[model samples]
Target: MKRVVVGLSGGVDSSVAAYLLQEQGYEVIGLFMKNWHDDSVTISNECPWLEDSNDALLVAEKLGIPFQTVDLSEQYKERIVDYMFNEYEKGRTPNPDVLCNREIKFDVFMKIALSLGADYVATGHYCRKGILEKDGEEVYQLLAGVDGNKDQSYFLCQLSQEQLAKSLFPIGELTKPQVREIAARMELVTAEKKDSQGLCFIGKVRLPEFLQQQLQPKEGLIFEVDADSPVYHQEQPTFASQEEELAYLSKNIAYTPELGKVVGKHQGAHYFTIGQRKGLNVGGTKEPLFIIATDVTSNTIYTGQGNNHPGLFKKALFIQQPEVHWIREDLKLKAGEKMEVMARIRYRQPLQKATLFQFEDGMYVLFEEPQSAITEGQFVSWHIGEELVGSGVIS
Candidate 1:
């Protein structure tokens, strides 16, 4: 029997994954990863790792599978935690969960499983894998889960062709309710456990507080820019090439101190992101104020009156060539090439119609409709039908 190492995350989904793999005649070994160790920085009583490890052990025991815990705290800190701090410090919004899957789970943990003679590493992610023959070569496809409401293909967007080759997602075909029913029938300990809302493996995080541990607080000005600012109505420049046009369209608008009235002050501009509406704590507006942009170098946050702020939306975003990754390498676009694909910048976002343009500088995704946030440091994935072909970090 082919041995499969299941990342039993002590959550209901992973619990059911292990059971299903066993029934499918695969030799399953349950491995729970201890990704975080610093409880001081972690929020108070927010699903501690110790508790999760115990729960994972219980699930493995009930399933009659050999189980062990792997302490990957050092790798987690260097790969995910440190990178998160570095990105936020630079005033960019980073997605740690996506990085976690790409760096730690698939890269580090996968290597360990392979060393143990396992043919594959499985997870409980709500996404599917598909294989097809293309030009006499086996092509792997990363597909959206059957359960539309719970599809997590976006989180695994950074995965490459080789990573998808040995990865298995066992619960992709079932909806959330069906997974719960299966766990309930199995009398699993995680059957009724609520899903983790915090960082991957690192429980509930108070982002501001967690960030404060690494980024020292410095007071900064919050200016509310008028919606009718001249920056919005500026004359378009002549584009010599598609790359130049995309480069201009994807760039963030710079806000000056004189742009608007000083609405409030923030601890730090780095703590905030584009399209943020909360934690501003500034009241007394006709409509709730939303953060339109932030300047970490100037230590200022530019805000707009409401959700309809022109600065809140962008039609295009650029991804550096080095950051771009293609799961379907066969479908990669060459220089000056473009393809129509459905793409989204973040998870749970309904796929929007977009066109991917590839140039020497990088790849750009221009959406048919304006997308909100479009924050830097976040990964954007493009799909054709159900198969995710490529993804890249938003520049």
Candidate 2:
């Protein structure tokens, strides 16, 4: 019998995933990942780690599968938590869920499952895995889940072919409603549990409060730039190469006091990100203000009056050579080559029409339509049809 280890995340999707694997005749084991134990930093009140673990145990028992809990708090901190703090300190937003799956679940947890003689590791991600044959070689394809509304292919965008080889997503073919119906029919403890929110392991947290734990509050100036400012009409530099053109195009506009009027003050410039609308607390505007730029060095925030602000959109973004990742390495683009692909900067955003330009320094993704808030430290996943081909950190 093929043995499979399912990561029972104390949620309905994972609960049903374990049951399906058992019905399919696999020797299944339910392992609950206890990734965070530090309550001092965790801000959520109800449904804490203890509750999640107990629910996982109940589901495993009902499914008649071996159940155990693994303490990955140490590794989680080092890989996800610490990495997040460092990114925020650098004024860049990081996606911890993506990193957690790549650095922890598939890497660390998979090792433990392999040590236990398991043939494959499984999760409840709403994405499908496909196999294709090319030149007598097996290539794995990460396809979007059939349920378009909940397709989570972006979170698994960084997964490599080898990782996908030994992985199974039993619930990929089902919709959120269908997964819940199955769990309800099975009377699982997590049958009607709401999806966990906020950080990957840590529960829902007030982001500003969470950051304040590590980042001290410092007063900074907030300057609101006009939509038709002279800065927006500045002359562009001629680029000799694609890399130079992309690098110049992808960077944020340089704003000075001459370009905008001082509007208000912020607690910290590092706490705010590009395109953020809320938490500004600044009023008396025709339209709501949105963050267009943040200068951590100057401790300044540059804002624009409305959603249609010129500063809110960009035509291109660059990913450095070191940050580029191709799940299908066999289909990677070489220098001076280009490909037309659909890409999205954030999870759940509809993929946009874009062209990928490869260069010696990095890859450039130029969207046919301007992309809003192309923030750094976020992964941009490109797709050919429904398959995710590559992803990279937006730089």
Candidate 3:
């Protein structure tokens, strides 16, 4: 029998995944990843790792599979936590869950499983894998889950062809409700456990408090720019080429203190993000104010009156050449070539129609409709039909 290592995350989905793999006649081993250790930052009584580890052990015992816990705290801190702090310090929002899957789970954990004579490593992610033949070579495809409402292909966007080759997503074909039902039948300990809402493998966190741990607070002024500000009335300039036009459209508007009146003050500009509406604490506006820009260098926060503010939307976004990742290398675009694809900048977002343009320096994704909060340091994934072809960090 082929050997498989399942990342039994102490959740209902993973529990069901282990059971299904066992029924398929594979020699399965359960491994629960302990990715975090600092509970001081996590909310009290949340889904702590101890509870999760114990539950994973119970599931493994019930399934009659050998199990162990892998402590990846050091790697997680360096790869995901440190990177998150660095990004936020530079006024950019980083997706740690995506990073966790890429750096820790698939890279580090997969290597460990391979050393143990496992042919594949499985997870409970709500995404599917497909195989295609191209030029007599086997090509792997990362397809969206059958469950539209629970599709999680966006989180695995950074996966490569080789990574996909050794990965298995057993619950991808089942919806959330179906997985729950299976777990109920199996009487898994996690059958009724609520899904974790915090960072991957880490419990729920008070973000501001978490950041405050390392990022010292500094008072900053918050300015509210008007919808009709003169900055938005700039005359359109003629573009020399399509690339030039895309560059202009994707450019972020610079904000200065003089752009608007001071509405309030914030503990730190780095704590906020584009399109954020909460934690402002400022009141008395005709409409609720939303964060449009944050300048860490100046420690200033810029806000717009409402969600409809033009500053919050962009028609295009650029991705540096080094940052672009292609899961399907065969379908990569050549320089001066463009392809129509569906793309999303954040997880759980509905796919939007976009065109991908490749140039010598980088790639640009121009959307059919303006997108809000095209924040830097976030991954933007592109798909063709149900297969995720490529992804890149927004520049």
Candidate that would win on lDDT: 3
Cα displacement (Å) at residue 169, model 2: 0.5
What number of backbone clashes does candidate 3 have, counting pairs of residues 3 or more apart or in separate chains? 0
Q: For each candidate, give its TM-score against the true structure.
A: 0.98, 0.97, 0.99
lDDT of 3 by residue, 1-395 (tens): 98999998889989999999999999999999998888899998899899989999999999999999999999999999899999999999999988989999999999999999999999999999999888899999999999999999999999998899999999999999999999999888889989988888888999999999889999999999999999999998999999999999999999898999999999999999999999999999999999999999999999999899988999999999999999999999999999999999999899999999999999999999999999999999999999999999998
Per-residue C-alpha lDDT of model 2 across residues 336-377, encoded as one tens digit per residue: 999999999999999999999988788999999998899988
- Please give the range of 10 consecutive residues that has the lowest summed lDDT in model 3: 194-203
Tens digit of lDDT per residue, candidate 1, span 1-395? 99999998899999999999999999999999999877887777779988888999999999999999999999999999999999998989999999999999999999999999999999999999999998898899999999999999999998988999999999999999999999999999999999988899999988899999999999999999999998899999999977889889898887899878898889999999988899999999999998888999999999998898898999999988998899899998998899999999989999999999998878999999999889999989999999888999998
- Evaluated at residue 83, the lDDT of candidate 2 is 87
Once superposed on the true structure, which residue ranges of model 2 sit more than 4 Å away at CA?
Answer: none
User: Considering only N, C-alpha and C atoms within 3 Å, which residue pairs clash in candidate 1?
Assistant: none
For model 3 the TM-score comes to 0.99
Better lDDT candidate (1, 3): 3
lDDT of each: 0.93, 0.91, 0.94
